[model samples]
Target: MATAKTEKLSASLEDYLEAIYNLSVDGSVARSKNIAQALEVSRASVTGALRILAEKQLVNYKPYGYITLTKQGCIEAQRVVRKHNIIEKFFVDVLGVEHTVAQKAACEAEHAFGPQIVEKLLCFIEFVNSYNKNGYDLHDEFRSFFRKHGSIAAGDSN
Candidate 1:
């Protein structure tokens, strides 16, 4: 719902938004110093990012005041969080990737894929889950096949 302006956010801004969302999940105030620590960026960098986000109406920022996400900002941040979760699950559950590796990979991928691809992936994951839940064995078959032969290729002689 808040994605119209969110679509214009750079990846770095998206990261900042996500970090703010995560930090604020406990309903505590998110200070600039905390945001900087969470993002491993300098306070000056956080200040700059907060200013840009404020201009976009994504954050409420007053110099020396606590920073908070505007409703739109919260929505956009949650979207990023959801994408990261989905990608991590897809990697670990479907591809048999290790959890730590999947987490790192998901962070990179969440920003790379567009909505259509993400929607398709979500559908595919749900289908696979339903299939497995109904006593089908596609999960094991796919995992075994991938382990044996990596990614499938076109016109492969099998």
Candidate 2:
């Protein structure tokens, strides 16, 4: 399900798109200064990225003005966001990672995997959730097994 926009989006561009999408989640205009703050990048950098995105028809960018995604842009942004969320959930729920750690790791991973992997991951997460609801308690079982066989030094509960 990869689109032209998605296929050509570099990791840095994807980050900017994700930031803009998150900033404008409530239908507000995403200003360049705001985008700079959100991404911790310079306003010049944001502008450059916005230019590329605009050329790709992913964003409607005007000089020194607020930014907004086109319909195709929004769809691509949502796909990226969904991948990030799925990876984060897998880290937290299945791997027992800390919330912050999971979020950071997912941020890195979101750009690596493609739509097919992300869709499969979503299904795996749903299956695990349903399995847990059916009293499988897979998380606890993993924790128990890890505690018994984990290679970390003694007295480490993580």
lDDT tens digits, residue span 39-158, model 1: 889999999999999988889988888789998999899999999888888988887777888887888788998889888988888887778555767789887788788965536331
User: Model 1, stretches more than 4 Å misplaced?
Assistant: 1-7, 150-158
Model 2's lDDT to the true fold? 0.85
Looking at model 1, report the run of 10 residues with the lowest lDDT sum. 149-158
Model 1's alpha-carbon lDDT is 0.85
lDDT of each: 0.85, 0.85
Q: Tens digit of lDDT per residue, candidate 2, span 76-141?
A: 889888889999999999877779878888998999998789889889888876775557677788
List candidate 2 stretches off by more than 4 Å.
Answer: 1-7, 132-134, 153-158
Top model number, TM-score: 2
